[model samples]
Target: MTQAAADPRYGAAPPPRRRWRLSWNDPRTRNLAVQAAAIAVVAAAVWYLAGNAGRNLAARHIATGFAFLHRVAGIPIAEQPIPYDPATSTFARALLEGVLNTLKVSLAGIVLATILGTFVGIARLAPNWLLSRLAAVYVEVLRDIPLLLQLLFWYTLLQTLPAPRQAVHLGPAFLSNRGLRLPGLVWQPAHSWAALAALAGVVLSVLWARRARARQDATGVRPPVWPVAVALIIGLPVAVWAVLGAPLGFDVPVRKGFGFAGGVTVSPEYAALLAGLVIYTAAYVAEIVRSGIEAVPRGQWEAAGALGLRRGAILRMIVLPQALRVIIPPMTSEYLNLTKNSSLAVAIGYQDIVSIASTTLNQTGQAIEGIAIIMAVYLVISLTISLFMNWYNARVALVER
Candidate 1:
């Protein structure tokens, strides 16, 4: 700098580099300051609104807080996964029952929708033109129809079915206006113990799989996982059942007068809701799956095929795994949407959380608390789903060696 500046050959030395300062003139500083101000404004607005609500509630002599949760709830819920007596149960218990009911439908819908959607998505790209077209039509029709309308249609269709005595028989199951009656287990303590063992076996199988996968990465050869998984998950459960004196009783349904008795009853309300949610959500999920599969380069398929791999093998072994990285994020949203969409159960007289809360608020006139409970329930559910899906997504993400 000294020689060049003195000689005027390199012009003046460049100005000293400026150190960033937290001033209004600096863009980064100004942006942060603006964000802080916006956040403060939002906080202030929330505070004012909350204070006003409290004052209004107080002025009206309306009691607040969650004390009403302990009060008896007289709302009759048709489908309860847990024991719930409307006459004796508190609002808290009733609401808990509602939560369980919502979860029942939501969990089932997610599983069924995933399965159906994946198949339809694959069918969309099938070599058979008719199958592809049919799949396309199915996706288009389902996506275009409003979910609420579909729910209503399913409900109406179920209601029009023949009565209990004239139920359409399908093997051990029967469908009628009352509900679908299916064979069920005469559950026992032994069965419960076996189920617990099976769950433990599943956890152990997952651990074993991880170990096997790690071993495969370190060594070229991988150990078979299925045999060990089966031994743990199935054999362990059977052993537990046998040790506990295996009880294999079945609760077969029998026509008892006007209605069926024994076994399990899939109420029309639940069936309609479950069917509608799965079918409608599957269309969106199908599109997502198709896009994800398509995202896998054609070269991948060609490479796998060139190695003498069948189309199914290429898809299951290679393409599907790669496609998962693309599929999981949007798939998470579909799951959330299905869960949230279940709130619509109230429209068809299905006693989900929203329905129970609405009834509780109406009878008790504790609208704020009731609504808060619903918001909290959904918030918890959405967060849990998001967290699980994000974890899965990370696991499937590409890793560079």
Candidate 2:
């Protein structure tokens, strides 16, 4: 063998030293270079677009700043939960009121939709053919329809109801085209204290339940949790209320000459929006719930049954906890969707954030400012929900060693 070939590290002319290239020849360097180029292009495009917008606004004699935020909105919002006067409040304040109304509708819709969806989802799995088919029909029909059309249908249906003078009475409640009147709770200072105490008690009960569950898992003995939960959630509140002189009263709805009187009336627009949102969103939520429940392995059911657990116990103890891990992420998305879809309130003359912002834009010719406000409000809501959901997901995720 030749002297050069005898040394293992020495090859035949070292295979011609290839120069390291910074281009696509090297995968890592090429990817980094491509990403850098893409970022620069995007940055340049954004700057150009922003500059064009500024120039266009200036040429059109419109201010490009946020000074319009402080100007008076000069519009009255009927049926605001918080006290709002157009003459006294700034455009910002009116926008805040609209945001709150949007939140109220979305929050209520999420709660109602979850309850209805869960029931319908469980029903779809029924052993009885009629019950399962009924649930399937509901899911298919509702999910197939456009949400906007649903909203319109609900609004039209509400408008066709009898006028205030001939309102339908349901015990202490009244229903009419004008609104649905229900009894309102009159609260005193003591009621506030009772509410605070009740909230604290509920929080404490949840902590106790968590601890009890951990102890039970370690010792193979489950504690009686329901009675403690009930006491903390219900009895504590009642106890505090009694101690605080029971400062609570109901203002029941009563029939009056032209309208119902002495109760809180929810306008038809609000009712229609809420009802449509809940029903439409519930369809999607039902599907998510059904899929989640179905994803739980059949072995779990069999194992629980073999352990002599009742069907309800098997569902509550073994099935739901596992199913929730799959359910929560998609459920969070549905909630966020419902919140954004609430913007459709504009179609029915409901004073939601989008509707109010549109009116403000038309009145002040401050389209940019109005759009910015709407976008920021929605972004905040989306971010807040995403953060909470991510935190919850992390907590519930399966652990591995």
Best model per TM-score: 1
Model 2 lDDT per residue over 261-346, tens place: 79898999999999999998988888898998899999999999999999889888899889989999999999999999999999
TM-score of each: 0.90, 0.87
RMSD of each: 5.4, 6.8
Compared with the true structure, what per-residue lDDT tens digits does model 1 show for residues 192-261?
A: 9999999999999999999999999999689999999999999999999999888799889989988988
lDDT of 1 at 140: 100
Stretches of model 1 off by over 4 angstroms after superposition: 1-35, 170-172, 214-221
List where candidate 2 sits over 4 angstroms from the true fold: 1-32, 210-224, 253-261
Candidate-wise lDDT, in order: 0.94, 0.89
Model 2 residue 282 distance off true place after TM-score fit, in angstroms: 1.5
Alpha-carbon error at 376 in model 2, in Å? 1.6
